[model samples]
Target: MLKIKNLYVSINKNLIIKGLNLKIKKGEIHIIMGPNGSGKSTLSYIIAGKPKYKIEDGEILFNNKIINNLKPDKISKLGIFLSFQNPVEIDGLSMYNFIKSFIKKKNNNNILKNIYKKCEKLNINKKYLSRYFNLGFSGGEKKKNEILQMLILKPKLTILDEIDSGLDIDSLKNILNNIKQYINKKKKKRSLLIITHYTNIINYIKPNFVHIIYDGKIIKSGNKKLIKKIEKYGYNKFIN
Candidate 1:
């Protein structure tokens, strides 16, 4: 569903992603694990078309079309969803209003019903929906809010960055369950690219491929077994 070829990216004149190549196919779940400052999050931002990051070279193709120059909203409308590591709070906007505006389709009774069901599954209280978007919410609540948006949007390609961070065990399990359900519901029509530092989420959601990235490039590609190895030895051995 998504492909990146020899991607070279930079921010504020400092190179972040260096000649990175990755391909994620439909129905596949790929996890990228790397230490902080390894360019893992940069890859996600680039794919999401964040304007701050300049693509010095290479191309990003989604659904067989080049999207290197597309705006963030355009990329999102093309069925790509990115869950941020830190969700921003907008004091003036309520969660309900934000989501209602985000969804391109009409907001009808059926959509409301489906959204409520997803909220229940994610354990989000109805009252929270009426509150300002991510305003005064705890870390866990912010992450769950991100998942709630994902459930509502139902994008074809899902990119999660550090989704497990700050989530308690129960909340983490709930989020993972929701993600698994989404993938299963879409069958082979959906794809996921998860970037994380720990293997805790991997325990619940099995990835078809696990890639180890270092210094803005993927240095090793393997399967679930790599998760165990990383947990046992950590990323130090994978560096260099």
Candidate 2:
């Protein structure tokens, strides 16, 4: 569903992603692992059409169409969803209000019912629905809220950047289950590009492919065996 080829990206004139190439087919779950400053997050932002990063070379294609120049909103409307690693808090916008505005045109009673069902599954408190979006939420709360949005939006390609970071064991399991259910609901029509540092989440998600990235390039790619290798020896051997 998403194809990135020879992608060189930079911010403030400093190159961050150099010759990165990745292909995520429809319904495939892919995980990207790398140490800090390896441009993992940069690649996600570029795919989501964040304007701050300039594409110096290569192309990003979504559904076989070039999306290198599309705006973030356009990219989102085209079925690409990115859950932020650090979700920002809006001071006065209630979570309910934010989601209502976000879903856009699907605010009927049935949709509301579905939203509440998702909230229950994600363990989001009913009271949080009235609070300002992400305002004063714990790290785990923010992560759960991201999953809540994912459930509501139902994007074709979900890019979760460290969704497991602050989650506890129970919350992690709940979120992972929700994700698996969602993917199964659509019969392998949804895809995910999960970027995480630890392998704990993978134990639950069971990604179809695991990639080790270093210096803005994928150094190795494998199946589940790669996850076990990274958990054992770390990324040192993958780095030059």
Ten contiguous residues with the weakest lDDT in model 2? 103-112
TM-score of each: 0.97, 0.97
Candidate 2: pairs in clash: none
Write the residue-wise lDDT of candidate 2 on 85-122 in tens digits.
Answer: 99999999998888888776664787678778989999
Clashes in candidate 1: how many? 0
What candidate 1 gets wrong by more than 4 Å, as runs, is none
lDDT of 1 by residue, 1-240 (tens): 899999999999999999999999999999999988999999999999999999999999999999999999999989999999999999989888888887667856766777788889999998998899999999999999999998888899999999999999999998998899999997799999999988877779999999999999999899999999999988887774
Single out the weakest 10-residue window by summed lDDT for candidate 1.
102-111
Note the Cα lDDT for every prediction shown: 0.92, 0.90
State the lDDT at 200 in candidate 2: 76
